[model samples]
Target: MALKINKTAVKEAKAGDKPQELRFEDGLILRVQPSGVRTYYVEVARGKRVRIGRVGTVTPAMAAEAAKRLSVKVMGEGVEAVMPVRAITLEKFIADVYEPFVEHEHRRGKRTAEDLRRSFADLLSTKLDRITSRELDAWVRGRREDGVKAATIAREANQLQGALRFAVERKHLKVSPFDTWKAPNVPQGNVERYLTTQEKAAIRKALSDRDRQQARERASANKWRRERRYPELPMVADHVMPMVLVLLNTGMRYGEVVKLEWQAVNLTTRTITVVGEKAKAGRGRIIQLNDEALKVLTTWRALTNRTTGLVFQCDGEPIKSIKTAWKTIKKMSGVENVRIHDLRHDFASSIVQRGGSVYVVQKLLGHGNVSQTMRYAHLADEQAAKAVALLDGHKRGGR
Candidate 1:
């Protein structure tokens, strides 16, 4: 190891190949700091060192003894739990330890992995050994104080916990500091909101108006395009009634509905089977086609390529997203609170209101749990009311 010395002492010691300010030679490296304090560091390891203690005065003998003691302590602390420099540096650990674990959890969606990745992009670049637990605690505390949702903060904290656990397993960290960190409280309930019958009718009506307007605009545009002798008009019906009908008919998610394959869809049996990892639940389910859904499917199938292998593809590529079209449709339909997932809610609600049981609804909706199926229990309650009325009528007739 080496000791740092103040300048005046070095000049007095007739130091060779060293600055005059460096008074101490053994176990210390010198820096004439901007703050004017002669800071002291012990060279505990080769090319790696720790600041032992600062000595303002240039005392060579006293500094050497201090450096020797501090070096021994730093070395001892690291022998058991404290991580070495190679393990805790900014560039040293992120690529090696953190990102891979986050990505692995992301695949299974144990949490919102991508969101966590974005949130931690710069944060994890900090050196673990240099960063105090108090700094991390304050960072979390600041986020909470900034009006960020408690639930969101809790999830982020959980992700951090997972990262720390991974570090601990590799001994880069001694223990997960967040093992006892509390997450925000969340309430229980599967409360759902659905479009009323009138609301549903108004939306469909408004969609029709929007589709007609779109058709007119396309016709005008096509007239202009045809002057150049194009093979066909570029007028598309993808943003029309056919699309809305497609979503309402099949309770399939916007993503799933847009990416259906003709080979997977059995038009003869009016069944649509979807199998892909793109599903949020990561499981495929069979979609039953009603008359409205079937008609739309048939029309779409005939309108697109008979030679092409894929169904519902536009411009020769399978549709990946329809969010823009949905946004336009919602505004046209006059349903401000509507979401694409609400179409799914609409399907389950329709099934339940039309005398389907919760179990049937569960199967139709492809929910993993029955608790998710019970929000439609109110529909079954309607049947009980009908039964009660029938019983009252029979009792009166007997009297």
Candidate 2:
């Protein structure tokens, strides 16, 4: 029975086995359960319900007043108007929306999403609409004051802009705070640093020295294994030399080389296919093995007992990093201001120095774009000069 629900009537009303709802004026309602618990709700529209409060905890007059106000709001603003009041926070948006979209939709790595999360920690709790460009500027300024490089800040800002755009696209936000915001400018081209021929030789000598030491250790270990000694000699460094050789030869990133499996290498074809997740570009590329690279791989493969899985392994597993080994090699080799990645640059530089076209270098290095190949264009200047010199031999009217 629909009766005007007041506090006295609410107390008097009893529910049967099923729960009962008492309707009041202006869409106010009191729901009574079989156990005699009562709760109030306001039916703003046909299918839209908004909970106000419980029967006793909130007096009937107060619920009625709230319901009346909400009814006015619904009449004036419509049912869909409550979204801003329930807008998701920045943290929720990042966790629920941005991260999933980046990892799955964008096909980006987990490291990228993690970096964005870390970079935006300061603004994680703020609402999307409340986040202003001024706030972003302050964040950039704070990052700069904290000794972070401008390039790094620029990357973080670009990530932030992407996230904001994502939010807008999903309708979680009406407009991006970064729509007109200016991110810090980073240098256009990559910082190219290639090892000189002498530097390369020094590094190779250092690696060879370590290799000799490792060989001696291996021989001793083999003797111990044959004699069935208590503990066979511990496994010495075997991966570093081969890994370094591959990096220097093929120009593969450290990640690509470390993750390389035996299946990727085809000795007959003289090619290594960097495929699937192993490639940075999300596509496969073939790396042709030079004589030196082929020799190193052949030797390493001959010595390796396990023919399957990662070509480079430490303790029968893929090696995550070569930082310590590389640091020691760099120190011993006396090659200053060169990184492991510079090996790839050196490889490209070597190709360009040998009169190889930039297009050839690009194909060899597996670069996605020619622009990435253009950084080593400076290496071709001598060849260009030589080409011009050839024209001088046929000159008849030039001064």
Candidate 3:
């Protein structure tokens, strides 16, 4: 139940000797709100109802909506709040509000969130409402230093556009800066690089090496797992190498891949179930396991006590933030500029290369929307090219 406020009367209460009161569903009043001072106010609990802080001092209509939101929040709905409706800056806006709102997305969005967070964090300020196309153009233009690709820059820039659009919809910003802005020509650099069958063999070989080392060093499994307040990890053998194999097989976020619990993963069905609060969306997801991902899990399952469902934890602790160790693993693997997340792109890319449809790829990636899956469509095109190339080669001469 929600309290409905007759905002017009609430304003009248502020103006007259007899204060007008509008009660919210939660037993609070719109209370006595004055014009040009504090948008919204509510009465608190106890014998004497207390007034909470004012949301804004804008207008009665606006104030009413703000009151509605507080009510929604108290009732456990995800109410969209206008934290700093007038104050707009990349840094301050993000600091004051956006961080808490998108904390859940960080678990699911993975490298996408990681990359966008870095770009948005840098913009600092360029006002949400008044952002001119010139400012946005210059914003990305400045970021295109030392040969940063335009496509990557454009993807990050789109986030600002989305944020501004949201602000405008909520009337926080009067105009979207990008409305007048023209997009720069985005240059496509590398086509998607998925692992070849041979590349898979190589990664499999590395996984096998990890398996063999584990066999020879059973005495050290306890030694390697033990630590004194995050002591230097064995770092390479147990978690690092196998993790890449896991990523190669399942299109999971680094967070999702590492956060895998044995309890969530069904060895019989070869699928992993992802739960809320650990996922980008505050909902659970299930990813089907391929033979290779299943094999890695099988080897891993025996070494653990099934006290928890987590499949990929280290010792008794869960693996969080694999950045430092991954950097080392990358150097050891001799792969340049290849990220852990690129493994997902690699997974999606492999699906398309092997003739998987875009629709199928979308489901495998577990995207809330298909646009995220569209990034790998180029791999599908590459498949088409190979088909045409074969047809031409069958003729006497290339067509």
Pairs with steric clashes in candidate 2:
none
**Span of ten consecutive residues with least summed lDDT in model 2:** 182-191
Deviation (Å) of 396 in candidate 1: 6.3
In candidate 3, what are the lDDT values of residues 185-225, reduced to their tens digit?
85444535455666566555655665566556764654665
- Rank by TM-score, highest first: 2, 1, 3
Can you give the TM-score per candidate against the true fold?
0.52, 0.52, 0.47
Off by over 4 Å in 3: 1-237, 397-399
> Over the stretch 1-399, how does candidate 1's per-residue lDDT look in tens digits?
333544455334433343333424444655445445555555555666555555546355566776666656766775333224345853455566666665575664434444454445445567654445565666564453222345666767776666667677777765455654444354322325578888788878877787788889888877777887766566666534666677777767665665566777888999988774645366777888899888877887776646336666667775544556666767776776565667777888888787878887777667778898898898779877887789888898995
Clashes in candidate 1: how many? Answer: 15
Worst 10 residues of 3 by lDDT: 76-85
Estimate every model's Cα lDDT from 0 to 1: 0.63, 0.79, 0.62
Ranking the candidates on lDDT from highest down gives 2, 1, 3
Model 3 residue 3 distance off true place after TM-score fit, in angstroms: 68
Please tell me which predicted candidate would have the highest lDDT against the true structure.
2
